[model samples]
Target chain A: MTYCVGLRMKRGLVFMSDTRTNAGVDNISTFRKMHTWCVPGERLVTLMTAGNLATTQAVISVLEERSKAQGERNPSILEQPSMFQVARLVGETLREVISERSTQGQAADSAFGATIIVGGQIDPGPPRLFLIYPEGNFIEASEDTPFFQIGETKYGRPMLLRGFSEDLTFPDAIKLLLVSFDSTLKANLSVGMPFDLQTYVADSFEIGHEDRITRDNPYYNEISEGWGRALREALGQLPPYDMG
Target chain B: MTYCVGLRMKRGLVFMSDTRTNAGVDNISTFRKMHTWCVPGERLVTLMTAGNLATTQAVISVLEERSKAQGERNPSILEQPSMFQVARLVGETLREVISERSTQGQAADSAFGATIIVGGQIDPGPPRLFLIYPEGNFIEASEDTPFFQIGETKYGRPMLLRGFSEDLTFPDAIKLLLVSFDSTLKANLSVGMPFDLQTYVADSFEIGHEDRITRDNPYYNEISEGWGRALREALGQLPPYDMG
Candidate 1:
């Protein structure tokens, strides 16, 4: 299981993902799920994956190799004219990886499936966000839906639904994402600490504040502990039910 | 999908369940899922069901018939001397209904499986709570685990885990449960409104407050709207994340 979310705010886009990966309850390891590619002033791309680890890693490796100067570069994500094309390339790469694994008769196609969230700015195009499915099709975030979440999403969704706004600032967006992640971490063991966070500003063509939040991060601890008390007090403030 | 919960507090037991049942997204109907059988001063039992509606209704029908004075009363739940025996009878009845459906070759065994939460008190016994599985096995709720929820449970669980306390009053417990249910209702279309609620006080040997909360129920409306503001305020009160 994994938890990853990308929010498209008025300021820009903010992405956060947990690093824990597990084959089963007995076997667990940490692997970064967020990958980034930036050509400084030209473009900035961020991708977060959730699902079969092998499939995601293969797709990432293929994208990385194609972007290299000495290798095949015809279909490189970095060279795509628009964020839409970059999303298409990533989707096709994910589909290709899954089909390749299944053709070897290693496992069923569904066993190698993965979902992805790819978003960022490409030159003159405005910053955009998309949730790419295992089938290789994708949908962009819009006014009605300003965010995307994949893997272990339910526990953290209510807060996100109620709190998101177009006028949110970079700091508040990060705070919201942390609260969502904190709820998930406390409820499920599969999603662990050492979170990767990256923010992008509209038209900046460069990544904004980025950090790796560790288990003992002072701010993370404060939010986790303080939110509980806040919720209790909030509950107390509601008028008592008239059980007449 | 459904949502039903039975919570045990020092004051006694509280139960709530949504009434929406569906064969598919297009076919949905409201059906009461909370069933109660009480002998007034002798015993009080409340059972909440989730899963195959047919199996649950059959089990409830059988229990009701046996409890009638005009029919077989030998193994009736009202005659049970202890809450444990009542739990065992309910579990066995559930298993019987499921196997009977499958033996007729109607469908797979799992298609008729149902899970139940039955808890109350009989003469000479303290209030107790039990969660019964489809296999005719059951587990009692202890101090460490004082609540049982079935169907569409994840969306509403984090709040229950954080809010439940042995020393909680009935009003506070109901408030917590309403907040939990409101979260589930908003997140899932399959779990709809007109919720049924029942509460039992320890050693009373009879049901206490019982109410059917409809969509326009003023207090529910208040809680649902108030919770959004309360949560937003709570988030604002938490120390802002330092994106340094």
Candidate 2:
């Protein structure tokens, strides 16, 4: 289990994911959920996945394999003209891996379910984000829905409900996400850190602003303590319920 | 789909549920998810359910029927001596109904996956909360884990994380729940409006302050707006991500 969020805002695209995975309670391990594919000045794509690690790894392996194939028309994400096409290629790969594994009787359902949040710019259009399903279908982000989440998404919905907006600054987005993630982490053990976060400033097809946010990350610690205090203060501020 | 939460706090107990039932996106209707059995100052038990509507309705109907039966040796919720016994009765009722319906083979295993949050006091004992699973087994809430959520639980976890505390006032608990429910409503269309909320003070067993909270409720409106503003303010307070 994991928690990952992709935001497509006016300034750029933001992708964040936790680095925790578990086969069961005893086999818990920290595995980064975010992966990047960049072509320097031409394109920069970030993919974050949730579900069975083997299945997601297989999907990514296939994409990397097809991309390096000698003049093959396998429709690698690097060669896709648009984010939509990239999503299609990712979905197709997910479907392919799932079908192959299911043939060997793995019961490829939610235990083996895989979904990806794909976000980046393709040189021609503005930054975009997509949530590609296990079935090889997907939905793109819109002004009405500026963010997409996968894995342990519900634990963080309340904060996103009121925090996400098209006009949000990249910093505000990251902070809102931190508070959201803190809330999720307290309630659910599946989504832990260190977090993998990357911000793409629309036309800046560079990949330097990536950070491996650990528990000791200074700003993160501030937000966690501040948000907890603020919440208790807020609760104290509300008018008491009078049942008389 | 449904959303229900039960809290066990020093102040007392709070139980709330949304009344929306849906088979799919198209088939949706309003049906109360709360059931109450009271004996003035003797025993007061409240049960809130989530999962297959048919299965829940069946369990409730059986409980209601058993409550009205006279001189029957078969144990039922109303006849139970302790709140723990009441939870056991609800679980047994749920398991019975599920076994009966499952024999018909109309639905899958998730159909029997109905969950109930049972809480209240029986005469001398303090107020307590228990979460009963479909198998008729249940777990009691403690100081370390003072709440239980069912149905569409994920979207509300963060809000509860931020807002919930053993020290919170009952009114604050209600407010926290509204924000949590609001988050859930915004994220999942399956859980919807006209919620049912009931709060019971420790010794004030006879007076169950249950209300049919609709979209027009003033306090509800305040919670939704206040939460939105509070989130924005909190996010605005975070330091901007220094992409230096």
Candidate 3:
């Protein structure tokens, strides 16, 4: 299971992904599911992926391999003309990855899904967010759905949906995400600790934050503590049940 | 679809369940999901159920029918000495309901899952919580897994896992549950408005606190507001991403 969220806020874009993966509960492992492509001030694109590991990595490898071609014109992340183009390229790349994996040799290997969040800014425009569906197509973020959550999203989504309002600062977005993630982590054994977090301020022409939070990360710990304490405090504040 | 949770805490037991039941997206109806048959001060018992309405109603019908019998000696709930026995009786009732439905001969449908939460204190012991499964079996709540959630539980399960501590006041428990349900309601279209909530103090020996929370419930509004405010505050406090 995976829990990755991309928030496209008035301030900028925030991306976070859990580092746990389990193939049946017994075979659990940590694998980074985020991919970053940076051309400094030119374009900063990041993708947080969820679903089949092999499929996701293969998609990333396709993009990476494209950037390394020696002779002909290669359409690479660095070469994409715009953020929209970058998303299109990603969809095309993922489509190819799944197609290549389809084979008669693989018996009973049927339905597949790989959802990805593409968010970033080119030096020219505001940071943007897109939800690339399993079908190799995507949708951009809008006022109605300002955020996209992939993998184990149901548990923590309400916080993002109802809590997210316009004019929300980058920081508020991050905090909402932590509680959402905190909620998800506690409920799901599949989504474990040590999260990969990245936040980019819109039009800053660079990523403002990037960190991997383990159980010991101070800020992460603080938010978790404050949330629990606040919850208790909130509970105390509620009018007592008139069961007496 | 419904959301029901049973928690066993030092202060006693808390049970809450949403009443909305829908067979599909279009046909939504409200049927009470909670039922209580208490001997009052001498014995207090509450039964909260979720899944397959027919099956659940059937189980309740059987139990109620037996309780009303003038002289029956077959391990009825009224005759049970311990809350554990009552749990078994509920589990057995569920098994019987499913079995009767299956024996009607339609290729043995696997469409039967009616789990019940039975919590109460008999004449003399600590109040306990039990989750009755479909197979005429049950599991009691313990310290490590202090709560049992049945039916549409995954979404809200995370919030409780993170926020639940034995020290949390019953109000806090209720607050946490409302937020959890809020998350579930937003993410899943099947679960909806107007929630049924009930909270019990350990040895009070009666259904003391109960409320029907509709769209206009004041406390419900406060919880949703406070939750959003806290998330935004938490986000503001996170260190800005420094992705170079």
**TM-score of the candidate numbered 1?**
0.95
Which of 2 and 3 is ahead in DockQ? 2
DockQ score for model 2: 0.55
lDDT scores of the candidates, listed in order: 0.90, 0.83, 0.79
When candidate 3 is compared with the true two-chain complex, its DockQ is 0.37
Native-to-model Cα distance after best TM-score fit, residue B151 in candidate 2, in Å: 1.3
In model 1, what are the clashing residue pairs, if there are any? Answer: none
State the fnat of model 1: 0.66
Residue by residue across B1-244, what tens digits does model 2's lDDT show?
8999998888889998999999889999999999888879787888899988888888887887755647653436767778888888888988988788888767674656698998999888889899998888999999888999999888887667667888777777888888788888888999989999898888876746878789998878877777677667766666766656
Per-residue lDDT value at B195 in model 3: 81
Could you give candidate 2's per-residue lDDT for residues A51-81 as a string of tens digits? Answer: 9899898988888884565675343788899
Worst 10 residues of 2 chain A by lDDT: A235-244
Best by TM-score: 1
Compose the digit string of candidate 3's lDDT tens values, residues A85-155: 88898888777777667653574454456888999988686788899977789999998888889999877
Off by over 4 Å in 2: A66-75, A104-111, A237-244, B66-75, B104-110
Winner by TM-score between candidate 2 and candidate 1: 1
Clashes of each: 0, 1, 11
The model with the greatest lDDT is 1
